[model samples]
Target: MKRHTAREKAFQLLFQMDLNEFDPNEELHEHHGEEEIDSFLETLVQGVVQQQTTIDENISYHLENWSIRRIASVEKTILRIATYEILYMEDIPTNVSINEAVELASKYGDEKSGKFVNGVLSKIIA
Candidate 1:
């Protein structure tokens, strides 16, 4: 799968994991069924899972006058994914991570989500 597509699927899986509290491996198998799992997708989901506390801490630190808890789950999840990429994924450029995250927020989150994500990620990379 293309990185874009893998990222999208990873977002969906992570979103579900956030909402449902399911294990990533089980959820991923259920998600793909007979299809082979995408390596990038697996890497993203697992990386986010392993590093979530650090990612959330980073995101929370970047927020201005906002508690991480107050953020909507969609925005929070998007932020987590982007933050993970920025901090952990050396191969992907920070700009690419931010742009892709903004796109995901624009597509899946509320009206303000894209800007909110961009703002927070900009702070993260700054």
Candidate 2:
């Protein structure tokens, strides 16, 4: 799968996991059906899960007045995914991650979410 597609799927899986508190394996199986799971997708979901504390800390540090918990769900998910890529996935460029995160936010979040994501990620990158 393309990285874009993988990222979106990872975001969806993460969102579901947060809402249902289900095991990642079960969430993947339930949402994905028989489709072949992309390795990149697996890496993203697992990476975010594995490094969530650090990622959330980074987010918290960068957020102006917003706690990580106070952010909207979709925006938080996008931020976590991008933050994982920025901090852990060395193969992806920082700009690419930020840009994709903004796109995801614009698509899935409120009107201001893209700007909010960009601001937080830019802070993290800086």
Candidate 3:
């Protein structure tokens, strides 16, 4: 799978994990259905899960007027995944992470979600 696809899958897994409290590994198995998990996908999910507290804190810090709890689940999940990549994955470019996150938000979240995500991530990046 392309890294983009891996990131999207990772986002989906994180979203499911956030909403349903499912284990990321279990969700990966259920989603993949015997296919091997892509290494990047595994890394993304594991990274987000392991560093969620710090990631959330970063997100909470950048959010303007909106609390982390107030962010939509889909938006928050995308933010978490992107934040993890931006802060932890040195190999990934900051613009790539931010752009992918905005794409995810545009695809999975409300109309304003992409803009909202961009705003928050830009703040974090700056």
Best by TM-score: 1
Taking every candidate in turn, the Cα RMSD to the unseen true structure, in Å, is 0.8, 1.0, 0.9
Tally clashing residue pairs in candidate 3.
0
List the pairs of residues colliding in candidate 1. none
Model 2, 1-126: lDDT tens digits are 899999999999999877778788777767778987789999999899989999999999998978888898899999999999999989899999999999999999889999999999999999
When sorted by TM-score, best at the front, the candidate numbers are: 1, 3, 2
lDDT of each: 0.92, 0.91, 0.92
Residue range 1-126, candidate 3, lDDT tens digits: 999999998987888788888788788888889888899999999999999999999999988788999988999999999999999999999999999999999999889999999999999999
Clashing pairs in 2: none
Off by over 4 Å in 1: none
lDDT of 1 by residue, 1-126 (tens): 999999999988888888899899999999889999999899999999999999999999999999999998888888988898889889999999999999999999988899999999999999
Clashes of each: 0, 0, 0
Native-to-model Cα distance after best TM-score fit, residue 57 in candidate 1, in Å: 0.5
Candidate 2 Cα RMSD (Å): 1.0
